[model samples]
Target chain A: MATNIVWHEASVSKEDRREKNDHGSFCLWFTGLSGSGKSTLANALAKYLFEANVQTYVLDGDNVRHGLNKDLGFTDEDRKENIRRIGEVSKLFVDGGQIVVTAFISPFREDRQQVRDILNENEFFEIYVNCSLDECEKRDPKGLYKKARNNEIKHFTGIDSPYEAPVNPELVVNTESQSIQESVKTIVQFLEEKGLIKSGISNGI
Target chain B: MATNIVWHEASVSKEDRREKNDHGSFCLWFTGLSGSGKSTLANALAKYLFEANVQTYVLDGDNVRHGLNKDLGFTDEDRKENIRRIGEVSKLFVDGGQIVVTAFISPFREDRQQVRDILNENEFFEIYVNCSLDECEKRDPKGLYKKARNNEIKHFTGIDSPYEAPVNPELVVNTESQSIQESVKTIVQFLEEKGLIKSGISNGI
Candidate 1:
């Protein structure tokens, strides 16, 4: 079916969009166990970048599941498809000249690697949000651990299911030790040091 | 798996991004048969809007299928899923504060309505690229019509399958009769008249 289709090139390329936005575009993929503060950190970073006039967007698990991945379930295959779709969407956002941040548990190394393979060099950054399963269970911000313990929810990451930590991520932020503000600062500092954003932006104040 | 998930609200919302970009965000869905100039018109409009300093993006069939919808095929169910996924992605672009244009065959009214139902009023504007099958086949930019006629392709819209035109589209630009420049001007004028975009932008010249 795709053989007959021809690619119609866009007049406004990613480089042009980046030049207009005054910043580089890339995807920041945050993976970790539940309650590890991936969503919190991603949102905080989005706010900081927006305040600094850097074009950015965050794709968290909840918001994405409600729309693009609504039809998917919690099977291992579905989980892989979920992360794959998110990676593709993030690629589109990057092409549109925005720093796209995605937060998900993403419990498999192979799935994460598949996402990375779809992106260009330096276009995908794996951010490992590190927190122990014990800490995550203790937090239980959404009472998910309790349900998983009660056998009410199956395939729960860090509970019944496995979470394969990143082997060599671009950055590692331990939410158990660092505050949300500190985590956001570390990420922003990394982006600036990598020349993703302008060097002198007051660190988002 | 989703029970433990909590929605983290973004500090910078679509409204804030729109304000920063100095324009509103909406989707211009271009629907018609293959070779009907949907991609051409959508790209023209995107370039015009981009030159006018209006944040814009075009989501076309070939590019999207090569990435996000690559797993899908041309079956009826797959076609519905394809449009559904595109609709979801376009919603994301709209949420990111961009005037997103989508080009797809999208031959079913019910499927198109499903997409329209997902968006709020004034957020989705369907543009019907009206062109006769004869004209489109004669043009045959991708030689798809020839393949379809030779029975090499099955379930091809307007040949082996059906194409349900929009009953009441926001606008209909007949590519057979109108120049691409005229078609773009009509659509842009409609956008301005509907206050979807700011007027007095010099037609992006």
Candidate 2:
């Protein structure tokens, strides 16, 4: 305990990075069903934030599954472990002074809570991307829903598996009802209001 | 495959982040025996980089073992997994456009090579913090050497286990001979010469 206090008092690496970057660093965790348009919205927001000069990065299945979590499978145990590692990586990004957007169908309340418990207050913002299962299945961006229907994939959230939504998320966006541009604007506005980022977004955007 | 190209051509998130942060991002991998001043020198270099307005963070056993790689142990296989996870996390930081300094014993050549292979060209810099085992045992910063000597710790690098030094490290600093300030300056100068960072360090420093 004493050592931790001395270390924090002596070496404020997070504070130094935030000051240098001229912004607050935190995780914008987007959770929902598999086909809930999480990747599209998260990438769009990342691009928008980059245009506004906010240091940002996105951690989706594309970058993660093939490398860090390749050994993990779709079993219940592996699902929890996957979310756990992603949460830990998000914390590192937060400490590095960048806004990290993680688009994962983190389907367990306890698992999500574990991540929230690990981060400092105001560092973990749960953004629940809401889309009805019917809608998501209808869209089926990656065709995983069809495979799940054919039993080609097991433990699929909203089909064979369960998706436990956030009990009290910081923000909830229903992508089915809103245009992508409007959804992106709403998130940017929320970030601006929270003072997590400065307002440099051009009016034309 | 086409999607990745389309995404890259459409959006350059990393380039955007680097421009905003005003510096290139990469990993400074510090490998050495325990108590060899790896942590001390990495932290000192981080402090120097932070003063120069370079986004920087150090991932050492203190911050990492308790969080990201908490499940990993000192066994040979776990050690490999530990380094692999750290390498992946470092890649995320680079994508986030921040210089991440990792200080670990990381004794195996193949393990270090795996990290280098995962990163893009110019994105990984292996820094060998060379210290004689005799000097390291004498300093014994954390009393780990005493425990290792008494057989309280097993598979300890430079003791019961072997430490494979880097054959073609980008840089090597002998903490036993050079002052901490001098070592930090040497690193800063190297970064400047490599165009990874600009020479903004004032003469007063």
Candidate 3:
């Protein structure tokens, strides 16, 4: 009877997937306060990589919660669960040999560390989209800061909730000072330097 | 200083990988008692898929513990961690659009549920490799039954620990009477039915 169990397994090996993609895939975790341009940067990075024929996907805070993690809430436990699911999803992309760019407030260090531990050591790259509370508030493109000030939003990372900056992120982008084009250029250059993109892959014009 | 922080990003897209692979990928979670032919069936399944030009990988119990899951143990917490990591890895494969086959003595319903919860509902396929303890002992392919009988292997499932059979598995393969070839054919048929694989794909003959 032991011979009767039929299991449908993976069709491709991990190495083959990586090779077919023509570049190593890893998690690009972006952490910052809301309106710090994390999602903007992540989107642009994904577009640039895609144009260059790189396999890429973006997991922004808003997009993921809308679908894959819609059941979660804003409470501490829910936030942790939210990040946990994202970490698992990101790990999936990395394993498939695709670059994954995730942007979230991700205020807690322990949660970020949990994500790192889930993936391989070198596969996780934390990018702190560093912008001061004042700067982020000024650029409150979503008016989230105003809502939080009016008590319309509770546990806002930079307000009632705390935003613990990464002690040592892979890249620190000051979104307040850099132009969007410049920021994308910097990120694209970083990806090229990391050999995620081919050498001399031009940033969008 | 920046070089110290590695940026891990994939240079490929999910659609690109899927187009190249010519099939969508998913995770096949196989649960059963040791010596029940989970690994035997998983290996044969992977081999068959590989030959058929489907990208595949198998995370067998012994192989995973020896590498990806080395830090874990038999304790409940460790077991949770073990299943959790496997879930993460499996998700990675699915994202890369490659089918992943995992075989473990994942004894508890709760643990298996946790894994399923981590994965998408449609992406997770639970295959129960059903073999009676009496049959498993008779097979004793790894001499594990002998070890357990001698008290050399403590906390062994179906001996010291409980082995909760899946109540409603997606597929039940009775290893007692079916031949290995029959088992592989059944699994492949399931995949084809699910539209995961094209019919008549030469799975490595």
Candidate 4:
């Protein structure tokens, strides 16, 4: 069946997209516990990049679960499938010549690794949103920790399920201590240093 | 569990993205049978849109099945799931302020309607790549038609399975008669006329 599938060569390649957008395309995969500021940081970075005339988009647990992965649940297998789909979608965005930022708890190391392996060497940047369980629980931005404590939610990362920290992530933002602005600065600085974007007068807050 | 999920509002909205791109964001969904020139026409439009400085991306069966929808097969259930996922992904691109063109066989009207229902009225443009099966078989761009005739493939659209055409598609490109350039010009003219794109000196051939 696979043999019957023919490859259609796209006249416009990723290089063409990048040349048009004036920046390289890649995925910024943010993995961490709930309330670790993954969504916040990802959105902040997206705004920064967008203002800089860089094509950018954000995919997070909230927006994704409501749409593409709506049928998926919180089971371990479902979680893996969720991340897998997001990885593939991110690849598409990168291929379209846009910077895609994805935020998910993504609790397992192998699951995150699978997403990274699907992209080219420099196309996937795994940014571990590092925060202690205590800090995340304290932030309790969505009251998820309270729900987990009350036994209302099962397999909650950092409470019931485990979150395997990235052994060697491309970048680590310690959101527990760093301000959101600082986190955005760190990421934008890395992007500039890597030549993903041409350095300009910083528009990032 | 649902109560624990809070929507994080981004500083950037779809309007912001559109303003930055200097064009409106929407999905140009091309539906037809295999060998109907959907991919060809979609890529042509994408190239045309890209050259116009409008952020555009093409999502077709070949590239999508190889990645995001890799797990899906040609089964009825899988096909429905495939289109559902594509609709959601297209929404993401539209939200990011891009004109996304998707080329899929998407033979089921209900499935196509499901995708249309997911987007705003004007945001989803259903383009029927109209071509008779006999014409497609004659073209036989991928030689799949021969295999289908030999019964080497199961549930081959227009061969064994049914293809429910769109009852009231936004536009129809009769690829059987119209050239690829003509098809692209028709679609681009529609976009410009609908004010989906700002009119410029037509670069289309």
Candidate 5:
């Protein structure tokens, strides 16, 4: 049945918000196996950007799975679907003129590429939290690796499933060796060099 | 089952990004029906913010449905899921210390409230794009109203489904009575009043 009501209408354009924020929006995607320190680096980078007075946000995998993606399981298809949803969300963030950092296992190459395709060129920076599987198991912050090794967990990346390393990442943080300070410095330097942060350097960092 | 590996820590924090960007990260959500001028406003807002040197991005409904929300259909579950994913993504953007403007129909009040809950109290700004149904029908740029009238589409908000009006919005823009110039001015004025923009008003406007 047709109704005479016209419901779709909203005001405020994208250009206006972008002008107010001062920096171009993009997604910083961090991919690695469980316990690879993707969350740690992403959080630190976000902090650095925050101090610099840049608009920013982070998507931690554990937090998301607990809420927005709660219904999703660990099956390969489910994981792909999960990444797909995150990708779309990331795209929205980019549109809003904010730097978006996503920390996820995102073990599939195709899925990561799919996310990149959704945004503008050079907006999606792939940061591989490069840590050996053995290293990640050693620092199992959530004990996920232990459960995976014990067969209590199924389809765990780097245990039963695969983690496709980035062939060419914009940045690769070797979490196994560098101190947190040094890692953050590298990320901050990258943002500064990219001109993402203009004027001051200590507002949102 | 736990192995040890060196972890690289970051020196900086999100505080630094905020200091540099000169503004806090948050979500500027634009809600209305399709062709209600949401995308147009969102895009223009991004542009304006960019010109003012504010970090920004825009998330339009059509653009998102084409990619991140592509796998899902138009069922209620899918719609909820879509908004949920967007909430998560906006959180990430705010974490990155960037401003975000999202334009979507976002028909239901509950769903919109869910997105607001995902954000910090002051971080979410609900900008209701207020336009009467009659004017919206006249501005049916996509001819969607025509399709709905012919029963070519189902579950369309304002046609077959219901649109829960926003009870309290941060800002309301009546696109019908206001010219794009006036509408943009209203938004810029809001940002200025909120201390988001530092540059002077656009002479062009």
Candidate 6:
């Protein structure tokens, strides 16, 4: 190597990216029961944010469970570790100045709290996708509820296991009472009002 | 709640992001001994890419070890798990339509090959930052080499642990023979020739 060779002074900072992206960055953590429309809401909102020129990505079981957390099983310990890794990954996306929307059952309050502890006060906004168990079971989007009822899926959340609902979430969208677009619009308006995202593109709420 | 709203046809695809960012999305995986300038080169190239309006992010020990892989230790199993998680995260970035630059002393060929298998053929590019052990030890950028020599660090690559060099790397920059600028220029030109990054900005070699 040349004697004069030196390290660059800095890498691009999160603020630099936020400025370039023209929006603040944070995590929109959507937790809900199976068939509660968490993934649908998360993806819909991500698409809306992308259209509005906000750097956004969705982290859901479809992308995460089979990839990053494949080694983890459905055991209690594995579930906790799964949430921890996902939280850390979400933090990285936020660090890159992109809004990361994650959809996971995340049944435990402790697991959700751990993720919150890792981020700043305003960086993690938990949005509870509220739905009655009867409604979720009726929808059974993935047939998970049927499997759980059949004793095929042991310790399934909101069935064999318990779901500790968020006592004080940043927002709550009752999926049973509203359409997906309505849920997306409510969240977008909330984010815009909170100054988490810039007000430019009309979300057509 | 409105009843007419429906799921969008698609979220942003990798192709859409590639066209939007005007650059190819892939992982530039840098592997070498400690103090071999992997982080420096990765960040410098990332800075260049960002300046060219390419969506780019770098995953290094500074950002990852203390957070995503904080629970992992120096054990062989832990190291393998660490690399696995990093590879999976890189795949997510590529899926999101951004070039991800990763700097780690990933010492196992099998681990590196696993990451390659997870990604498409062109998505994973292994760049060996070749530097002589003598030169790296002399640099001692983080004093890690000194600690390893003093037996203060266990399983330190190129000292107590082995570093399996790439059998068929996409590129190898001899850091012992060139400056950082030259290395960055070499990589930028190589990427341009391969159409990994669009040819627009003239990188001054």
lDDT of 6: 0.88
Predicted complex 3: DockQ: 0.11
Model 4, B19-124: lDDT tens per residue?
8887899999999989999998999888767777778899987679999999999888999999999999999999889999999999999998999999997899
Using lDDT as the measure, name the better of candidate 2 and candidate 6: 6
DockQ scores of the candidates: 0.27, 0.24, 0.11, 0.23, 0.14, 0.34
C-alpha RMSD of each candidate structure in angstroms: 6.6, 5.8, 7.5, 6.9, 8.4, 4.1
lDDT for each of the candidates? 0.87, 0.84, 0.77, 0.87, 0.74, 0.88
Ranking by TM-score: 6, 4, 1, 2, 5, 3
Per-residue CA lDDT of candidate 5, range A30-72, in tens?
9998888888888777656644545677777655787667889
**Whole-model lDDT, model 1:** 0.87
In model 2, residue pairs whose N, Cα or C atoms come closer than 3 Å (at least 3 residues apart or on different chains), thus clashing, are none
Q: Write the per-residue lDDT of candidate 1 for residues A38-105, one digit (tens) a residue.
A: 89888878887777778899898667999999999988888889999999999999989999999898
Give the runs in model 4 whose Cα sits over 4 Å from its true position: A1-10, A201-204, B1-10, B201-203
**TM-scores for candidates 1 onward, in order:** 0.94, 0.92, 0.67, 0.94, 0.75, 0.94
Top model number, lDDT: 6
Note the chain A TM-score of all models in turn: 0.93, 0.91, 0.91, 0.93, 0.88, 0.94
> Over the stretch A87-123, how does candidate 3's per-residue lDDT look in tens digits?
8767656765678899888999999999998888668
lDDT of 3 by residue, B1-205 (tens): 1222223333345556677678777889999999888888887887677656566767776546755555578898888778876776676667656788988989999988988887776789999998899999998998988998899998889988899999989988888888766777788878888887886553322
What lDDT score goes with residue B47 in model 1?
75
Instruction: DockQ winner between 2 and 3, please give it.
Output: 2
* TM-score of model 2 (first chain only): 0.91
lDDT of 2 by residue, B81-166 (tens): 99999998888888778899999999999999999999999999999999999999999988989999999998788999999999
lDDT, residue B107, model 5: 92
Model 3 residue B105 CA deviation in Å: 3.7
| Model 2 C-alpha lDDT per residue in residues A166-198, reported as the tens digit of each score | 989999899999876677777877887888876
